[model samples]
Target: MISALTIENYRGFKNFSMNKVKRINLIVGGNNIGKTSVLEAIMLIISKGDPQTIWKIISGRGEIVNYVGIPQGVIQPEISVRHLFHGHEVKLGSAFKISAIMTQANKSIDVDFKIIEAKQVDQILYASLPSEGMDTFGPKIALSITRSDKKNPLLLSIPLSSQGTLKQNTLQTLVNINFQQFPNEDERAVFQYIPTTSLTGQELISMWNAVALTAEEKRVVEALQSLDDNIEQVAAISSPVIFPQFGQKTGFIVKMRDLEKPVPIGSLGEGTWRMLVLAIALVKSKDAILLIDEIDIGLHFRALSSMWEMIVAASNRLNVQVFATTHNNDCIKSLAMLKESEISIQRIESFDGPAIYYSADEIRVAATRNIEVR
Candidate 1:
């Protein structure tokens, strides 16, 4: 797991550092404070010098406009990371700096690259640190989903670059992107980034039914199906669907639940989709870093507490490290309900021009008194 992540001269942040990531890390701050940029930095660093892949993961579309904000037309953003294993400390450094000189008409940016590993450079096979029982892939797995904008929205069945191009090869799963071509309007993409196993609410219910519950996994499935409000009950249905694969073109026909047979994903009630995605991600994201932004987007106040319980359990079972951002105080309160074993919470705030990260204990200290470090 990453012990610390450092960023310099990247989107909204001249310099930022986040350390001691536990099972669940929550970033709380105002907009444009680089919360998402921190996540983007992880994805870029893990891409290991592949600008194309980095661009796709960060911006969805491979566009230069996303990089326009960087001071100086410099490309290849710089990032550094520290990883800890057992008793050993491994420090990885990079200077993928860019040289851009502004001019009257236009400006130019040149990308430069530098890297250092703990021991010998040549001995390292991948760019990221290696962990036991897990493939580091030279960097960490950063799953990011940005909300949609009015002009350039994402579409359903959006083509994965790897699905067609030679250079397009990635081990990530993005689902439920919707694009529509209206007769009057010039094709609008409704939703931005929604990651879930099923596309529709009906499909979601079907998936819930399809889950071949083991004696242990059954407890989780039962808890999810027996929700109080909106979701009267969850019933599984049979369906032939294409399951997600990391690097291969392998898919399976599985059973799923129909959460929308009663209503559309747009109407099935808020947080329904978000909760479903969280459940599925927790189950599927074994040994991977799952990034969830604005986790409390939808759902009633009561649902928030239950959702946290489910999330905490899933992370522990799957051994997945989760990074999430939220501004909801209620969501934080819900997390406080968890037992020590259920979830480990790390509170981080962007203040005083930089990010201040704290462990659960440290956060308690700051909260006990009127300690506004900002």
Candidate 2:
């Protein structure tokens, strides 16, 4: 687990630091304060600048720069990776730094890289991006994502100009991440970001397929039961007539004691699918970090306490750390009622102010006293 996180010269933040993090941390604040950017930083640090996340963040902002080869080839970064820089400016000597320390040991990771102009690109060493009316390599940008435990670490350098130059062999996962503490770690610490709204039928089905393959299905069912006790069994169903894709992903079906036959998951209500997706995500995120944005968006106020209960229980059971954001008072008040897991309520101020931290007891007091932590 990470005890502290430090980010410098990243998007929307010239310098930022947040300490006193715990097993389950909930970030609360006003809008446009870079809450989602913090999660993106954590993802980049843990994944060691994986290109998938780079595309996700950029495409999430309506900027598409990924290219594919003739027939179903590896996805490569285009000229758009420069969007990662602060203010979308890719000037030389401008860089970003992200570091985190382990909570139980002295192990830590420091990742620092800068943007530099690449005038020449050799096909053997790096890929070349071709652009119109340019020099030999079409004004390429070369940057390497390198990390280590003070030893010889892994380095992945890619060119930002060429289309078909990048392949699967050019990029890789982080090596000896977290000071080599997890040299053999099964999964990366970072997971995909679950949006605030409920997942679509296909999205939930995809995640459900991942969870169904593991022993965590029972845990997911237990989590859904927290929201509604009538949930008996949850299953995935697919047919040529019912699904658009042929068995690639399946929709959900649930068995209720009152209902004679299995019914479609959507019939149970929006909250059912919302809570179900959260549980499935938790199960598939073992020994890793889960980033959820606006976690309390779709669930009703009455289910807030129960939702927190399931979240903490599953986090402890799976040894997963959670970082979520919200601006709901009921969500904050219900957070204080959780007894199974430790909580850290952080208040992020706008304009690069220091983050305010609050303990569980302090949060309970704030809720009872009607104090505004936000």
Candidate 3:
């Protein structure tokens, strides 16, 4: 588990630190206070500065610029690296670093991202460039991951276009090459990030397939039962080829205790789907980390406590560390019902300001006093 985390020159933060990180840490703050950025930073660190993950973070926010008049076969989206820095301007040496102290190892893990000249990278990486005679002498984005136990850092870089932005296809080619060269880079830990809207139909199908017929699948069913006790079994069925549109949108069907036939998971409501996503994510991230943004999106206030309980129990049993953000008061108060040692809350006021951390006891007191932490 992370005992503490520090973010410097990343997204909305110039310099920020959160202490007393526990097994399950809930982040609370006002809108646009960089709550979600914190999750992205953690994801970057866990992924060891993966280029594809970086692009996902940028494109997820609609930060990419679409270009027209490009050749028919060429990718047209471009992502600016400047938006990732604190000042939103990328100059030589401009960099951001995310570091955390692991309680179990009593050591720190750091991932540094910086802008550098393209010439500094190996020429072999440029072989996949387009044949349109695009210049490869411009600046590039470089990433380096350092661990306390390792002697050398793991390095990766992607070239930038003459416009000083990352082209979609260029990045994809570089990522493909690097994956083949270093296939086991992500063997360290399993990291899963659940966005605000939750997982999609295909995403849920993939996750369900990973744990099907295993003990983890049982946990997922139990989580669904929290929303509806009659939920007996859950399965991901193939989308019908003849009438794909008529099939379950999420490709999941549930067998109810009293019902004669299986019902589409979408028929159960948003809460059921949200619970399923959370449960599958927790199980899939066993012995690793799970990050969720706007965790209370679709559930009723009455179910928030049960949701937290399930999260706490599954995280403890699976040895997974969870960091979730929420603005719901019911979600904040729900933590008070859990053991104080197992949870913590971090509150942010602004991007460049200090973070206020509350331990489990402090959270319990705040809940008892009806204080507004969110």
Candidate 4:
């Protein structure tokens, strides 16, 4: 678990540090106060500066722009890196660094991102260039990623198109290479990120398949039962219809105790789907880290306590560290009920100021005193 997190020159933060981070930390703040950016920073560090993760973070925010390919007419999407920095503009020496101190190891993991001008010494970094234009690979700009645990830094030359953006294909190739080198999933830590909109049907099906026949599946079913006691079993199945637009081509269906026929999980309501997704994600993230944005979404206020209860129980059993953001006071107060779980509340004032962290005792005091933690 990360005991402390420090961000420098990252999105919306010039220099920020938050200490006393517990196993389950809830981040609260006003709109555009960089609540989600904190999650992104943690994702980057946990990924060990993987280019694929960087592409996902930037592209998810619609920061990509279209450019004509090397073969001339074909269009390709390029991820803009400027938005990732503090000033939202990329200069010759722009950089950002994120570091965290692990409580178990008592050591820090660091991920640094820097923009440097490409030189002759950087020619060896052009291993994943486009096939057609191998000779014209003289890029003026390059993004250098350095990790504390890694001996050598990853240098990716930025293509000279629309403010020197990174090509999606380039990052994908790097990701493939990384996967080939590290093929086994158990060799690395599991990292799962749930967004405000929750997991899509395809994502949910894939996650369910990961824990389908294992003991984790039972936990998922129990989580759903918290919302609806009638939920007896859950399974992911392929739809008879071929097209997804017409209907869900593949999704989860639930067997109810009262009903004879299996019903689509979506038919039950958004709360059930949300609970199912959360449970599956938690199970899949055993012995790892789970980052959730807007965790209180798609659920009634009545179910907030149950949701936190399930989260606390699963995270404790699985040894998973969870960092979630929320604006709901009920969701914040619910943490006080789970006394056994190590909880922390991080409140962000603004980009110009530091974040305030409250310990488990402080959280209980705030809840008892009816203080506005949000």
Model 3 over residues 96-115: C-alpha lDDT tens digits? 89988888889888888877
**Candidate 2 clash pair list:** 128-162, 129-161, 129-162
- State the lDDT at 303 in candidate 3: 88
Cand. 1 Cα-lDDT: 0.42
Candidate scoring better on lDDT of 1 and 4: 4
Full candidate order by lDDT, most accurate first: 4, 3, 2, 1
Q: Which stretches of candidate 1 lie over 4 Å from their true place?
A: 47-53, 61-220, 229-267, 341-354, 362-374
Q: Against the true structure, what is every candidate's RMSD?
A: 17.4, 5.0, 3.0, 3.1
| Lowest lDDT 10-residue stretch of candidate 2 | 169-178
Model 4: per-residue lDDT, tens digit, 1-374?
Answer: 88899999998898988888988999999999999999999988887776667877988888976654766667667778889988887767889999999888999989888888766654555554664333354446677787886555553444322265777666666556556533454454458899887877777776676688898888788888888899999998765333357443238789999999999887888889888889988988988999999998888888888999889988999999999999998888888777754888999997866689888888888989999989
Superior candidate under TM-score, 2 versus 4: 4
Q: Which ten residues in a row have the lowest lDDT in candidate 1?
A: 78-87
- Candidate 3 local lDDT, residue 345: 90
Tens-digit lDDT string for candidate 2 (129-218): 232212354445555556754574534445444321222223332221223433332354356577665455666665666688566787
TM-score of each: 0.52, 0.82, 0.89, 0.90
How high is the lDDT of residue 126 in model 1?
20
TM-score for predicted model 1 compared with the true structure: 0.52
Q: Cα lDDT of all candidates, in order?
A: 0.42, 0.69, 0.79, 0.80
Cα deviation of 41, candidate 3, in Å: 0.4
